[model samples]
Target: MSPAFRWFHQDVSSRYTGLLCLFAGLLLPFAFAPVGIGLLAVPLLAWLFFAWSDASPRQAFRYGFLFGLGQFTAGVYWIYHSLYEFGHIPTPVSMLLVVVLAAGLALYPAAAGYLANRISLSAPSMRLLAIYPASWLLMEWLRGFVLTGFPWLNLGASQTDTLLAGWMPVVGEYGVTLLLGVSAGALVSLFRFRSGYRWPVAVTLLSALWISGWVLQQQNWTETSASLSVSLVQGNTPQELKWDPDARTKILNSYLILSEEVWKRDLVIWPETAIPAFAQDIEKFTQGLSGLTKLTGSDLITGIPMVEKGRYYNAIITLGSESGRYYKRHLVPFGEYIPLGSAFGSLLDLLHVPMSDFSTGRLDQPPLKVAGQLAGLSICYEIAFSSVIRAQLPQAGFLVNLSNNAWFGDSIAPHQILQLSRVRAMETGRAVLSSTNDGITAVVDHRGQIQAQAPQFIGTVLNAEVLVQTGATPFVRWGEWPVIIFAILLLVAGFVRSCYQENQPEEKTRG
Candidate 1:
């Protein structure tokens, strides 16, 4: 072939590579909730690694960004329903914001690809097996907390239904993410090196990882303390009705009517903002509910907004024998409060979101003492951040996440939250009770199995008995630092090797 023809062919191949990267990202969400074919995860990520391998640093960055753009756009597109349908924003603007958010998130993966290529390792096998995967894990961890974080759709969450979830109790979600990336990297390595030792090593590593996960899964890290009967009430209140002042009475009645039968149970849960009014504004009404709880010998946990002095907080308050109040720690940026400063504060006004400017609860607050055990508390978006839930572990007997999914309308957002809660359960060795305002009101046992669930768009109650766990998983004891530090060390070691290569004398060449 002529030199010009070869150049044209290479350029065309690169363009096709870019398109394939975007296609991988678009289909990635099927590996997650609602659809939940986690078997697709390894193949999808394998394609991404393969695409990144042959690209220059700049081309790799673009490919990685497009991949992330596609993944995030599909994974969290339900935000459009909240923004346009509930926030009352114009359709075009709502979609534009979603696009812009996806674009911003894309930068994390772009940085991963750039760093991986810029610090490319000398050994082909090492680069394919370790360097690419470490870069991906580091970026994934960064995405969870920087600028108030949106850790939605984490790769490990997809593994909740897969055998790899057995690794969650040992390594936590991020560790599982690293393992998943490594699995993807192994695929790329297997194809790149077809001879001798490297192929055998790749096969051994893949088989060992999966076999260990299966083995680790049979070992129970936590033991049952007591079996407690719990009921989760699904009010199914429409987002419009919950926020409207005139409909507060109807919404309040719906919950009250639903709970009347379950008050005899040990603990009854109401979804986020189930009261739909400030606690101070309904002091007497709250006392009546408190009285009812005392009468039935039960503890009732309900989401309500509270005010103290001048600050507002989204809180879960318990009434009856073991009473306590736990406020939400992490709040969603636009949905809960405005970030940065006053310039963005007007979004609440334009969007007309009720009780949107909530002050964040102190991170030091202890788990709530309710029912017969200490219950770790998370409100809505808080469950998305594994670290937030991790902080309360070993001490709290179980977990409870109060959510109002009505704002998301008929979208995968509801199911995704449930997926995150399952990951949280396995990581902490505690059963997670997910109580939502609409659909997916269910119970996830400590092993991350769904015990039972109520269908969405219905006013009902789900009753199940769960064992309160008494011990912590390895993930809870050591946290995510081990995996993160491992990734950091890999990059640092690569940098040192590159420096050594640069400092070495070049061999003399004959003229």
Candidate 2:
């Protein structure tokens, strides 16, 4: 083995290896939003791969758990802001809640590590190269699906500004994540085989993965067509004051006055729940706005709750030339609605989140027509789901995301969510107009680049032009299947190879 490789494995068994793993995990979040040091993800993941490959299954689980604990604690610290600041939870309780959540998330990684080590591939190299990568991918998929799926701080999201981002449209977010695991595995293979000729081959494979990303960036998956001028309104309304009966009129007037300045624009968008009243109660107000938009030859989209058959839906409604409504499909747990409400009825009361009971929109809801084009709508957390956004493609030319991030205070949730929006744009090859209640409102181009962004905690308008995209990207068509399929194949191959090797040893002994 190379001297560096030998030294690294030696250090992995050192007394402070657990501490080192935790420190590495803590640094992983920096590779993502707000602080965006994109290149850090690979090396850190490689280090974790090394620790897992060298440890027993029990030790690997511990290492993975510690790494995940650090990752969630650092990356999702903003969750505390929502709980304590908006949910009205006490400081002590909020801190405890954050720790509990982080610990719960950590189990996913721990399970991945334990499963990978338990599989017992014939060779150490195969364990890292095939089994480990598949395990990680499966766990990531589980994290995004099981129990309503947190899906935050995904490794692929860290590559948003990197050359790898170009791969998004072709292979999707999970594909990039799988590739990162491959790169990390190849890197560890270099150390495992440094004394042999195979190490050079490992180095070559690692180089190709990154070099291919740079090459992919030059290709355009979707062509930009007509452009429409749009205005995104940031009301800067405090969460505490938004629903107050006395402040309702003032908040409504604030949006109207801000929007009037840009009334001539092709489209005007308001953040989620900007109306601060149910759609049934605000028909007259909506008609007035609709009339204004019609007079100006523009379309208006605003967020409000829609009441139907005693069920309430968190919806965004179109006014003027286009008339449509899109309710949020993937609702935020506790924040949007309580899960298993009958059994856990009082949990909502203790959490104190507002608008805590909203019915989910139908899965096949059509895209909204606006500004002379078809626009896919994702309210709040829905945009984070690639499948949800992909369903709109080949039909919707642009994407619109409306969010009320005031509940998160001035924490990093808005910036993190903005990063996710950019990745969605890259994945679908569509321009995204992300309108937020207080901050980080911006326009993201099909290339996943932020064109223009409004400052946080400001009452202002972000005026920009977004292009309409006509076709669908490969990711939009194939969805997450390709990546999931690839991972499954790797796991199958690894197990088959292990079985073959075991039989070979037995046959030689019998001969």
Candidate 3:
């Protein structure tokens, strides 16, 4: 190698390479949806290949940790905005806390990278491709399940605008992530090969995958149902003013007026915590809305706090004769309910996020029935979780997400979150109606297309005829259990291969 080439290689070999790759991954999403230019994955796979080529498990773990630190530090920087803006934490404390939390969140990805490196030691070449992708998937699943589950920044989410998005309705986000990882590994393998012949073969396969995805995108898997006209009401209430004693009546009146305008629609929706008061406390208002619903022969679903037995719940109530309740199942950690109460209870009290001590509702609560159809209800933070939404799919014809995005201000966080809601809609083949406080409230079709949307910070009502799906996608029917099984099979296969290699030491020389 030339002197400059050798120097460049050494730089890439340093710990900074992983960090650089992660930063690239973080920033790439802002530039392009799906961020699939493969810049992030390329360096990431290169680091894994080099680590596996030479390094102990402990060393690999350290390298992976550094990579994760960079990834999360950049990706979740917006988290600190909430702490500083709403939690009343000092700027320095909020920054430090966000860094610590990001570091902790990085552990899952670090562990996945460490495992991939270890597995690659015994099974080099294309075998690592399978093991690495599978390992990443398993780690992501764990990240989503363990703790309160922060599945933000999943690789598949980056593919939202790409042709790969066609795979969403089938295998869902994680499956698309697995495919992305596998593609990355294949690309790395191609780069490692000096022979010109290998490049063409790899390129051909990648092209074929892209072509297939495009074909899938052109295919219409489900027909839209013309049975429902929905209006999503964006109250556009400011976060600071939302819970003010003096502003409560004004906030309530704003929603009431908007709801009145949209009452003629088959169904009307409001953002999460739009009422900013307990169901019992707002009985008079609820009754008035119920009466209005009956008078119009339409149903209204609104987000409100439900107090029961001294515990508060972030809940959605259907106001009409067929009224029912759906409490938010997946609460935001720290934002909604603080985890490890003994350790952080005091800190949580210091943070002034209203309604942070919410009680989780029963997992098996029935779907919200509105206008003769069952609507799957997912509150603000709840839509990020697939399993939570999956449980309600069997009975739900459409999905309704009520959110207060004013907490996120004008940041891309709301837009990104809304994208996840779109993915969920595709996964279940159900039209998603999202009503947000401070805009981006949209009516997304089953295919994940936004049919109508209100601009940010605008108090507006969006009217659209939403489609209801009768049939379920494979993902809706089986949920993450199928993905879990696939991950388990991959792990088992990797273990079996490892044992076989131990018995036949000669196979090691083949690579």
Candidate 4:
């Protein structure tokens, strides 16, 4: 029997494989923040390749689904917190929604496993190095775009603190995912390579990826244009009172009072829906804000719902110096705009969500002019999409992300979004001013480092001098196409090779 054949193609499946996958899935969250052992993503993913090495297509599917179940189960538990604690959804329904969302996402991993086995690759290196990662990346890419996408918890986001982040400017997050997948495949090769230079090759692959990332990190993709002094307001408005009529004037007064002393800064940011009412409803107040910002030479950008011809929008408006307005283009399903509302009419009536029907702004909305600079704007959930940030780039000197994560309330979701906004900063080669209601108001520099941040659940202002940058990273110029296309080509090569092996019945007696 050939050593390569025996190493990869085997009947050595174990009884504990299911639990192994389940626990390995559990390891997925630990690889990301709150417990940010970033490199753990390697060993965490290695378990999947290791388990699928000797399983049938059906077994591989089951194992993959279990791995995904474990992953989202741990990763997205905050959905329940957002729905029940803040949305005031019933406990039973909230729990069911969480389970359903996780199960739906699990299908991607399950498909990855089924395809890996269905495509025959007897040669150990080819199977582990090519077919495996490519299959995984393609499935994940699909998961990111389908149904307006939930690109959260993508493996690439977990690599922000790693050397792999150096590659982010050039290839974006999914590219990092592809590279990370290769790293996981190499890890499995280390254990199964048996004898010869395959072990050294696997080591070399990992080292090259790490070294390249570090080397890339040292290169300056964007040049500093100027330093802009900024202040972020953490209103600490409880989600329960955020939309309350009695609390409306008090909330507005609290934010205005907090900014009283800090308006001299170049830019002042407020969290999503900080106004807590329609712009027309508070026209007199907005006019006064415009006058105040102009008097202080500060550009104030805040989230205030705008009503235009009777359509509602979750929008960001700039006042003073040069003004610009951007309505959120990517709306969160059910939260921002319900999907198939009529189909789930009964359920919707029960949930009674607010700001749930926001109309999306134009896709080509230009960046807002603020503080003598142009900045990209993303409202709450919109920051998760790279397109929302990139569309404003080459024109935008910095990025502004406004969110109301009080709904998440002390969950890792707030931290997770903070992490993601930083990734956008890295990808676009632009500074990011991400302000959230209550906590995690932070300023991230062009290199994706946090310059300053406010403490969670505080009604205080976080002030910092942020660098405004010029020029675009490769990611801004070219989106995820390079990585997506590369994955597609790799899968094609694997399929063709698998087909050749099938037609060659007389070729080998390996194993």
Candidate 5:
């Protein structure tokens, strides 16, 4: 075997091997936003594929789970900060929650590793190139969908700032995952066959993909129609003070006072729950504000909780141009609405968050018309769902993402979310207006590049012009169907080949 492939012979059950896998996973998050070194994912995943080589299903599961546990434990440790510092959970219980969540997420990778090895072909080329990538993406797809999903820390997220990001408008994030997996598999093949004829071929193919991405990045999938001047208000209200009765008026006044200067602009936006009061409770105030904006021909959009028919909803309302509203559909688990609320009702009492039972919005709500452009609204966590973003389509000229990230403090969660919002802009070929309470309030162009931004932990307003994009990218049209179908086919083919190989050896032994 080539020296490059020698690692494949290492004992999977060895203590040192497990440690190395854990370390690899720990290093994975640095590849994502706020520390954007995307190339690290290639070698890390290659190492994982090598460790899985020649391992039993059980051994593969253990190695994969360890990697996942380490990955989540490091990547999303911010959850502990939110739960304890913000949710008011005890320190020990918060730590325990993090551990349990990490362990649960680890099972996806464990299942993927088990299935990969169980159905792997004997040929090194086929096993690493086809089977491994397919299995990995299948797990990623499943992870994104199962139990309302928590698609954080996806491998493709690391590629957001790299050349691979260009593939987003064409195939969306999952398609980018498939491309990334193929690159990792190629890296493994290149190393495993260093002395064979295929190593050079792998090198050529890898270079082609990277170069193709760069070329794709140069093309414009969506056309810029008109530009609308906008102002995004960042209240920067502390989470502790947000729900306090005395602070409610202060928060509303702060946003209004900030907008007083920029109300002449085509559109003005506020962060999620900027009002900190129910829509009906503030009806007279909203109506007066709406009249003022109408007189000035300015459209004002702000986040506020709404109580109608005795059901509360987390929603955004537009008060000018063409009046409309968008209620958030994909509510945050526990934060917005508790999942399995009946069973977890007692547990939710321990959480300090307010209005934790907001009802989901209708799936078919139309985009709000702001300054003659259709604006798709995503309140906080809803931006993480690509399908929900894509559903707006070519009709919604640009996207407006309103969020209150103060709950996560200064952790990487907010930065990671900003990164995801950028990807969403790229995927749909629309400029994104990402307005937040505490930071990262920015204007992203159609290409997913940040044009302007506000600093975190400050009360400020971001002023910029976003282009109305008209054409649709391939991703906006097809969504994840193509890549998903391709992954399923690859998995089936890999297992069929493995079955044939298993039978051939038995026939020869019988002869």
Candidate 6:
């Protein structure tokens, strides 16, 4: 065979391997729904082994990037639905846009792999196992924070149903990612190459850590407060109809009918913007609902549009209470408010979205008091951000997310958004109640498992007794500080070590 042909074949094989790893990572999360805990770790371990074998830093990065592309492509394929259905883009253009976004996201993982390779070059022994995992998590953290942050598929989310989920409340998802990556890397190192028993040592340590997680899972970390019987109303309204003047009554009636059936419950919740009108305009309607809440003695939290001082907000209003107003702080760019309006104002006209100039609320707004408990309210897109939720944790006993997923239609967007909410619930050790206009409305426990859920595109109400954890979890108290500090320290140490090694002089023997 020609040398050039051999090279091409080898490159294709490497890229294919990377793609497989990416697919495996994406599939790993679904496995938790049915597969045993023992089997769930196999794919991750395999990916780590692949990384270990790719001694070339460039090859390792390529593999990691391809893997990330596949994972995100599958996980966020629903993004195209929004572009096509609402953005009024051509189907092909919409698909291409989604692919480009996925590719940009994939870069973070590729960068992480490159950094891990650099660290491994310095310490190729079992020590690389620890450094690689820490560095990879640091990259994930950077990805979450840098440029408005899109932290969709952190590795720890895959273990939401496993005993390892117990670690979530203590360390948060980023920490869990660190632990999982380290364990996977150590396991790969232990068995893949003959390394003078160091591999065995690493594997034993990881096994012990896994056992520790099992023990922790059995412990009740927080005292549960009085369970609140809550009803989540999913209206299943289409995005096009949600804002239509003629369909306003239809949207309102849909939620009212579903909510009336469960008004006897302690609380009734509706997804974000379930009422597509401004608070001031809907005074009479809100008053009627308030009267119902008063009569039934049940608190109601529903999303609505609000306008104050010529500024619009995507907000949550609590009926039956004097303090019935909370505005969304973290507004979605383009969707809610356009950035750099001076330059992009014309783009809005092309996009053709109404109410694209929403304002942000204060960062330190108090949690909504509902059904005798303080519930943190994150409107739609805000739940994707950990810092926003972390800020609300101090005053909140549980979490409530109001989202209108109608824009994304019958797409995976709702599922992907729900997954992020589950991670937030696990991180804060708070029961999360997510109500959506088009569905995936569900209650996720502190351990990140879906306790109960309303299926997609279904006009239904889910009634359940959700437990609230009174005290704060470790994640809530410290937030992501520990992980951030650890990552910074690792990067600094790695850089210093690299410098020292590079500066070291080569000693000459007697020639």
lDDT (Cα atoms) of all candidates against the true structure: 0.87, 0.88, 0.75, 0.87, 0.86, 0.76
Instruction: Estimate, for each residue in 1-511, the C-alpha lDDT of model 1 and write its tens digit.
Output: 2344245347755568778888899999999999999878898988888777767789879989999999999988998988888778899999999999999999988998888888755576777778888999999999999999888778888998777888999999999888998888888667766776877788998988888989989999999988888999999988877778899888888889988888899999998889989998988988999999999988999999998789899999999886778888999887778887478977788888888888999898888877879999999899988788988888999999999888888899888999998999999999999999997899999999899999999999999998899988999999999999999999888878766765555532321
- Against the true structure, candidate 3 has what lDDT? 0.75
Please list all clashing residue pairs in model 4, or write none if there are none: none
In model 3, which runs have C-alpha deviations exceeding 4 angstroms? 1-11, 14-16, 31-56, 120-123, 196-201, 503-511
Q: Give the clashing pairs for model 2.
A: none
Please provide, for model 6 over 1-511, each residue's C-alpha lDDT reduced to its tens digit, 9 standing for 90 to 100.
2354345347854556666667665665453322324346544644644454554678767766776677677767777877787889899998898889888887877777777676534455433466567767887888776876777666776666666677878888887877787677766555544547665777786787688888877766567877989999988888877789899997898888877778888889988888889988888998899999989888999999999998888889998644468999887777788889899888687777777898999998988788888989898888878889988776788899999887777666777678778879888878899998878899998667789988788899899989878778788889878987886687677777776776565422322
Q: How far off is residue 264 in model 3, in Å?
A: 1.1
Each prediction's TM-score versus the true structure: 0.96, 0.97, 0.91, 0.96, 0.97, 0.90
lDDT ranking of the models: 2, 1, 4, 5, 6, 3
Q: Score residue 313 of candidate 6 by CA lDDT.
A: 86
Candidate 5: worst-modelled 10 consecutive residues by lDDT: 4-13
- Which whole-number lDDT from 0 to 100 does residue 465 have in model 3? 90
- Estimate the overall C-alpha local distance difference test score of candidate 1: 0.87
The residue-level lDDT of candidate 3 at 213 comes to 69
Global CA lDDT of candidate 6, please?
0.76
Q: Model 4 off-target regions past 4 Å?
A: 1-12, 506-511
lDDT of 3 by residue, 2-109 (tens): 344345457665646555545544554552222334335445544454444345556666666666676677667777888889988899998999789878877876
Report how far residue 4 has shifted in candidate 6, in Å: 26
Query: Which one wins by TM-score: 1 or 6?
Result: 1
Cα RMSD (Å) per model? Answer: 2.9, 1.4, 3.3, 2.7, 1.5, 4.1
Q: How many residue pairs clash in all the candidates, one count each?
A: 1, 0, 3, 0, 0, 2
